[model samples]
Target: MTRKIIAMAATVICVLGGFTASASSVAQDNPTVKEVKLRAEFYQNELDLLLDKARRGNFADFYQDVVKFAHYGEKYPQYLLGVMLLKGDGVQQDIGQGLVWIRLALEQKNTEWQKVYDSITAKLTKEQLDALEPMYETYKARFGVQAQKMSCNNEKMEASNIRIHQCRKTLVLKEFYSVYEYN
Candidate 1:
């Protein structure tokens, strides 16, 4: 299972090269449905892998997968990671950490993700709530930077395209941005 997750993640990296948008683009702004679809096409397989792992209580690999997925702006794994941490499934049970992960998932623009955050909020204590705020601020800053790592504008890309790729690269990301902004 671990091998499968690693392999799928590697596949995502390979296919990401062909995506029209860069992760950096998504990081700078909200991802369009098209950009999200492009990413989902690349990510779904891996997401399935992680979901299976989480379902079976495979915490260690699931945790690693969640970290990788979090870097990609995926909220599903973040939600699952919250569950795992809350239950101490693979990692130590830590509600504070779980809430932080859930909040991060909710911030990523998924209404479904927000449901999990709301459910958590309904159950937390004042102490947990207190711990969650500062942790959320820290996560927001870090997530903003890491969210773009899932896009295609990393070291693998040609240096020449770095500045100009957003324009010349497939209308995928820019097109996504242009179209997405309207909605």
Candidate 2:
């Protein structure tokens, strides 16, 4: 009786395995599945080619490919291309354009890339800094007055009649006069 039960169980298991294998084969023949598999294959092929170029230190080829990938508006590719440009590893050194791309990457709010963005910004020029003024103004205008206000508040204790906020974000005050005194 035990041998009969074991044989029955083996038969059931084989039947279930055969059904699963046939079902998977049918699914694989579905047009949608075929299309998805084809697209995945193409994507992987392109990725592999790009990685191979990068590994070979063929930066110019990799850079151009990256630009093409970036033009597709892929955020990670844009960030990588910007980093390459900033470092002058492959493409021409264009800090301004690199900052633009890095800013675009940051605008996606990808916190993972924030360190790269910050590192690139640290090496930016005065001109690049000036160029971001419009972006700051736009953000302030869109986000409201509170966003524009410097992020500092201090209790006043006057030393020699001057009240200092000591905020790092504040512009250097060329001249300071109270509103009442100025008026």
Candidate 3:
């Protein structure tokens, strides 16, 4: 049972995008880590699966999740948000918004997505690009992100190890970029 639980937790962590330095160095508490781990599980099974559903040609569902995921600060969703908005896939065509989303995606990681960025840029005029500045600032402000501890309440963390828990959250004081949360 213990081995099984450890394996399950490890799998969930993989699905949650794995451990981060911030998650490890932030806090040293079992309860907090447990909750955050639950949040990660939720993120993987729910949000990640939603993206898969969208890929199967569910635009309406895809668009809905995209709106919520826009605030989640992950690369793939941000990229998708950009592409869909740019091409008017389901949401209204908004080149400026597309640029913002794609750019935000780029900021998340250095990936092989330059082509997408290039394709979008190729079509924009200098004037349009210039005009995008104001809106871009607004988008950037909203989309700006930093590493944050995934959170859950005490009840949620009952399964976590104290050592594991300590390495799972930020210990120092922080004004986090985003917290994985559901209402």
Best prediction by lDDT: 3
Worst 10 residues of 2 by lDDT: 174-183
Of 2 and 3, the candidate ahead on lDDT is: 3
Full-model lDDT, candidate 3: 0.51
TM per candidate comes to 0.49, 0.42, 0.56
User: lDDT per residue, candidate 2, 9-42, as tens digits?
Assistant: 2343344332111122112221221101114345
- Cα displacement (angstroms), candidate 2, residue 118, comes to 1.9
Candidate 1: worst-modelled 10 consecutive residues by lDDT: 174-183
Score candidate 2 by TM-score against the native: 0.42
CA lDDT of each prediction against the hidden true structure? 0.51, 0.45, 0.51
lDDT of 3 by residue, 25-62 (tens): 12233222111232445555667687778769666667
lDDT of 1 by residue, 82-176 (tens): 66655566786555666677777664445555655565465445654664566565555545324333332323246554332111112345332
Q: Pick the winner on TM-score between candidates 2 and 3.
A: 3
Ranking by TM-score: 3, 1, 2
> For candidate 2, what is the lDDT?
0.45
